[model samples]
Target: MVIVLDFGGQYNQLIARRVRECNVYCEVLPYTTSLDRIREIAPKGIIFTGGPASVYAPDAPSIDPGIFSLGIPVLGICYGCQLMTYLLGGTVSKAPVREYGRTEITVSDSSNLFKEVTTNTICWMSHTDYIEKPAAGFTVVASSDSCPIAAIENTERNLYGVQFHPEVVHTPEGTKMLHNFLYRVCNCNGDWVMSSFAEEAVANLKAKIGDKKVLCALSGGVDSSVAAVMISKAVGKQLTCIFVDHGLLRKNEGDEVEEIFTKQFDVNFVRVNAQQRFYDKLAGVCEPEQKRKIIGEEFIRVFEEEAKKIGTVDFLVQGTIYPDVIESGLGKSAVIKSHHNVGGLPDYVDFKEIIEPLRNLFKDEVRKVGLELGIPEKLVFRQPFPGPGLAIRIIGDVTPEKIAILQDADYIYREEIAKAGLDRSIGQYFAVLTNLRSVGVMGDERTYDYTIALRAVTTTDFMTAEFAELPWELLGRISNRIVNEVKHVNRICYDITGKPPATIEWE
Candidate 1:
């Protein structure tokens, strides 16, 4: 496994993700991590993540120089690279012209790290400083116009550094460089599999919760259900899943979650119909973030209430995956969004011990593990939804009137997408209801009601995404179904914009 040392770089998690893509597990640690702790892990390889810091900064982060002499293979990225040079007796100062985005670099001297990588390569560069001179015994292997010392290496010490990021797609062959480091430099065997991870996670969970009961905050989504299943396998009836049916869920979703968990899986499951309770707290909320905050708080209140009824429980399991944690701003990263499981933990909650089985895994990894554990494909592949549920989908204030209209329209859109066999193709597709109302003629009656918008996108990572190029006929079918079946919705529109200018959700 590889260890990624974070130095406040935004793309730090991406580095860990790329290593995992090479079938090697990697954990992100803060740059301030004590050297003794790192030695305990004794990782197969160490990766230094890029950051928004200058080596010349008076108070910039630094690690012990002895780390280079520890004999562990090291790969340093942009900020990480500069930090390496400054700490290892090399000169690093601000560049006259900062290199950012895509830039071309030429391989000056050959090294095992660049094996099979092109002599001339387009790399994603994002740094303000450049290395004036590399450390002692380190040779310049790659160079570019703006950043002459683009790549530096010391093969004898098993250390390498690159000025550009290879984790992003802009650097097409970046993953290859990491593979070379993992296999050649580090002599690592790629043996990390989700099945093995599941087995180990279950064992750990059981040992942690022996004889004590565990309750999961089940949201009926893949992440939560997978966590619930794994815990059930480990502690059987010792785990009780509480599915909170807040008023904001999609059409018939409450009933579906109950049936699937209670009748089919049959592990101690409890369904709470707290729709009115949630709605009461969420009344008059109009702002998007405010609504999310209120819903998240209400959810915890429900969970705390459930735990009190269930008696003694050691842990409260949440369905928090990697995206949720990264989005909520963890480990030298900015907060893109606050997930209920991440930031919504109010001061008052029943269980202090939180167990997140899928915290390290991505969305795709969770789905794979779910299928590997024999979970039905339908449940595993269900469209990703937020813990706040439909509250976020409603553009304005959420009410029974808005919820009913959006639910029917959303149902129609999903049904059409599935019928077209585009359910699995589109990354995340959903319907949004606005306070907007448009004029339309229905059987010679002039109707001015709600306007519904459809959104669909394809994404490798939720970080960057592109709008799905859905056919016009498919859109027409969805539009027609919504207009005909769902009253109070007269106009339908499709979101053609992608993640750059617009996020997937309207709010």
Candidate 2:
């Protein structure tokens, strides 16, 4: 296994995901992790994640210099590279020109890190500082036009550093470079698989939850469903799954979720139809973060109320994945958005503890574990849905009227995408009920109604995504059907913005 020392970098989890792709398990630990803890884990290799800090700053994050002499293979990226150089008595200062996107770099093929990577290749660079000189006994293995000493390696010490990021998709051969580091440099066996994770997780959960009642917030989506099944397998009837229908779900989703969990699973299943409870709380709220917090708090309150009827529940479970944690400002990363389960939890909770079994796994990895647990293929491959459900999908204050309109429009959009034989290929597709309204000539009469925005993206990992380019014919059909079939929708717009520019949900 490899351990990624996180220095508040946004891509810390992404680095671990890339390492796991090589069939090697990896975990991300904070930069403040002590040297003794690293030795206790005894990882085959160590990775330093990039952060938004200049190493020379007085308050910049730093590690113990003795970490270099531990005889473990270490790889540093971006800020990590500069920190490594600065700590090793090398020169690191601001570059003449800051590189923030894709750039071409020339590499020394002789270096083990670039074993199969091309000599001249494209890499993603996001740094203001550059390495001016290599440390003693370290060789400059890669360099770009604007920045010198783009990569450094101390062969005898098994240390490597790259000024550019190798975990992002913009770097075409980034995976190959990481694969080489994991197998060639670290000598990892690459024997880890999803099955191993499932077996280990069940055993650990059983030991931790002995003779205790567990309550799961099951949303019937892939993540929550997988978590529920895994917990049931561990404690059997001791686990109770509470499915909350907050009136913000897609068309018929609440009923569909109830039917599956109550009949299929052996655990104690309870469905709470608290539509009016949430509607009253969010009567006039418009801010996205506030809406998330209200809904999240309401969810906990509902669970607490349900737990009282069943006596005492020692633990509360949420289906929180890695993206939820990272997007909600994990470690040092900036908060892209606050996920209900992560950043939106209230200060006080009724449960003795909250357990998130799938917290470290990504969306795709969670699906793999779902399959390993023998969950039905239909449930395992269900589209990813947020814990906040359709509340965030609605742009402004959420009302029952807006919820109905959005659900109808979104169902039509999904139906057409699947009918066009593109549903499985697209990573995520949905519709947003924009607050904006416009005038239109419908049936030869002037009318004003809400506009629905459609979003679809293609991505292997949810971290970064590109807007999907649907054929014009298909897009036209979807737009035409949505306006004609869904009431209160006068216009349809397709969102061409990707993840960086716009999140998948409107709110």
Candidate 3:
């Protein structure tokens, strides 16, 4: 196990993901964690993450000096490196020429930290302070043009530090460096696999909800489906899944959900076709927040009614994953259209207890769990669909026709992505049905129609995302298909904006 002490780096979770990629379990903790608590986990290695603060500041965060004496293999990154140097009687001074982007680093002694690193390597540097002097036991391993102590290590103490961020993909050898740390330094067995996770999760669920009826709100997405399947395996007939189709689904999605849940998984599912109820509740609702609130309240009411009809349901099972819990209530607004059901949940709900089987997993890890649980690949790796369904996809009004148009456009976008064989590579790909309509020439005649924007992104976490680089030929093919096949869509465009200024979804 690898333990990362988070000093408030934005990429702290990225480090954890890299460690997990090497089949090693890792967790991130605040820098304020005590040495005694650290020892309790008995981690094989420790990583210190970068932060915004300079180590020379008067009120900067400082860890206990005793942490180094624990004899665990330690790797410090960026600001973490400066903190280690300053704590060990070294000097760190603010430099006038701060580096914030790419820098050239030359290997000094070919230390263990840079075992396979080339003589000249490109590194991602983001630091304003420099390590002016090294501690007594540490030696300079690598150096950049601007910073003298680019990397340092004390093999005897099993400590290593790098001034650049190796966890980021911008650094070419980032993944390789992380692999070296996990395999060479920590000597991990590399045995954490999906099958083991599934087994453990099943055991935990059975133990937690022994003889208790669990009611899961199935949203027909991969996460909810996988959670429902796992719960069924835990307590055979004691689980009941309620799938609410709130009049906001894509074309024929409610029937698909009913057919799949009842026919494939064979779980005891209650199909609540509350389309008219949802439409009636959402009459004259133009604001996004109001729509979300109305849908949320309706969902809870539907679930409560289903739970009562099914007799005593003790546990309210949810498919709330890690990112959903992190984004909400942290004062962080949704950067993308968050996987719904988890995002826009109502406050008013009465249930015995809540059970979230996939709470600790990420989006990718949830797919792995689904694969382990024998879910079909098509359903497991399907592009994420929002819980609000086509309601969010329709830019302005929530009408059946608007949803139909958006669904047709979205279907074309997804079909093209899969046809290009980029579905697995791309993190998320969706179509945004813009509210504005423009005039166009069709068949040498002037006509007015709606425009559809295609968006695809590649990201490990949806928090920060960049537009995916789709091949030009594939883009052209998709645009042609959307305009020719989908009615009322005369123009097609691609979304080139990242997470900050533009979200993945228009709504």
lDDT of 2 by residue, 124-147 (tens): 999999898878889999998887
Q: Please say which candidate is ahead in TM-score: 2 or 3.
A: 3
For candidate 1, the lDDT comes to 0.85
Models, CA RMSD each: 2.4, 3.0, 3.1
Off by over 4 Å in 1: 323-352
Index of the highest-TM-score prediction = 1
User: Which stretches of model 2 miss by more than 4 angstroms?
Assistant: 280-294, 324-350, 395-401, 435-449, 458-466, 497-503
Q: Enumerate residue pairs that collide in model 1.
A: none
C-alpha RMSD between model 3 and the true structure: 3.1
| Cand. 3 Cα-lDDT | 0.82
Residue 429 shift from truth in candidate 3, angstroms: 2.1
For model 1, how does the per-residue alpha-carbon lDDT over 1-507 read when each residue is reduced to its tens digit?
789988888787788888988999988887777778888999998999888878888878778888888889999999888888889999998888877898999975368788999999999999889999999999999988788899999999998999999899899989999998999899888999888988898899888888887878788888899989888878888889888888788898788778777776748988888988878887888899998778877787787788688876678888888867767765445677777662255455556588888899888889988987778888899888877889999987888889999999999898889999999888999999987988889999999998998899998766668989999999998898899999888999888898888877777
Whichever of 1 and 2 has more lDDT, that candidate is: 2
Q: Order the numbered candidates by lDDT, best leading.
A: 2, 1, 3
Per-residue lDDT tens digits for candidate 3, residues 237-356, read 788888888877766667877877777775788888888887788666777777777777778788777766777668877888766654342222223234446444444444678888
lDDT of each: 0.85, 0.87, 0.82
